[model samples]
Target: MEQATLQTPLGMATILGDRNGIRAIRVTDHSEGEDSIPPALAEACGQLREYFNGERTVFDLPLAPEGTDFQQTVWQALLGIPYGKTISYMDLAKQLGDPAAIRAVAAANGKNPLWIVIPCHRVIGSDGSLTGYAGGIHRKKWLLNHESANPQQSLF
Candidate 1:
């Protein structure tokens, strides 16, 4: 698998994938040395940069995140969430046809590896509050604020 690390405004982010598609995009401590970036990873980095710059809202890159069938299902549902919108965990579970699966859905959501790419940050608490996030609540707030202020616009 190929990998590339970037210093995003939020922090350091690493992209990992191969010819299949992008597998993961996670924030991590800065890694040493400059690794050669694969084409797909390069493209992912560019798009992420555009996203941070507020010049882009929607992403159109191939993704191949690794997870279980259930987790995969939850991740796919997350993608369906429109840009600049937020949904509660209960709402997400209901969308998956199992309102009782809120906890399970939250667990799967927590395991999302694609980070900003999968748009997991769009998920929030049922109380309309920003909750747990692997990238920290501060980053989550930033992402939500960013999206709310810079929603996708039609080219037409």
Candidate 2:
């Protein structure tokens, strides 16, 4: 699979994938000069740049996230979430027609390989608190705020 590093308002993120589709996009602490945006990853990198620039809300690209059936279902459901909206894990569980699977749903959410594209940051705690985020709570908050804000402020 090909890999590339993109610099966003949140930080430097490494996007991994190939012709199959984007598999993962994770923030890393690597230095700036090492970016390697290949053709397969250029679209993703550009879209992510647009996202940070507040010019995009929905993502339209091939995806190939690796996960279990349940996890894949959860991730697909996450894609249905609107850009500026938020949902509680419990609500997500109920949406799946299994309120008892709240924990399982949350676990699946946590395992999402694609970051902003999957919009896992849109999910929060039942009490409306910003809960756990693989990318860090601050980034989650920033993403939610970015999506919700109007006038499309530039974070770069």
Candidate 3:
């Protein structure tokens, strides 16, 4: 596994990846040292910078998130969410064909590791309020605002 951290307007983000793909991207309070950047980490950082600069929409990188089968299914479902769109947890549950699993869907969403790439920030409360995000609600709002301001030209 390789790791690198970058400071963004929202906060410091730590990205972990391997030759297979990016595994995780999470916000952390600590800043990483210059020497800590691996070659793959540099590529990931560059992509993230491009994203923040509004030059990139979809990410082109490998992703290998570690999670259970159900968690992986939920995270994969998140990839279907459009860049500027938002979905309720209940909606996601229904999409999964399990309306009774709203809490389970929310739990799986909370466990998503690939943050922006998976687009977990697109999930919101049924009442249209921003809900829990591991990265922080402020960052979640920032991501949503960013996407809304710079809508993607093409989803694919």
TM-score-wise, the better of 1 and 3 is: 1
15-123 in candidate 2: lDDT tens per residue? 9999989999888655686466799999999999898988999999999999999999999999999989999999999999999999999999999999999999999
* lDDT over C-alpha atoms for residue 125 of model 1: 97
Alpha carbon lDDT of residue 115, candidate 3? 78
User: Which 10-residue window of candidate 2 scores lowest in summed lDDT?
Assistant: 28-37
Backbone collision count in every prediction? 0, 0, 2
TM-score of 3: 0.89
| Ordered list by TM-score, greatest first | 2, 1, 3
lDDT of 3 by residue, 64-93 (tens): 999999899999999999878999999999
Q: Which stretches of candidate 2 lie above 4 Å from their native place?
A: 150-156
Lowest lDDT 10-residue stretch of candidate 1: 28-37
Q: Candidate 3, which segments miss by more than 4 Å at Cα?
A: 32-36, 150-156
Model 2, residue 1: displacement in angstroms?
Answer: 0.3
Question: How high is the lDDT of residue 68 in model 2?
Answer: 96
Error of 2 at 97 (Å): 0.8
Arranged by lDDT with the best first, the candidates are: 2, 1, 3
- Quote each prediction's TM-score: 0.90, 0.93, 0.89
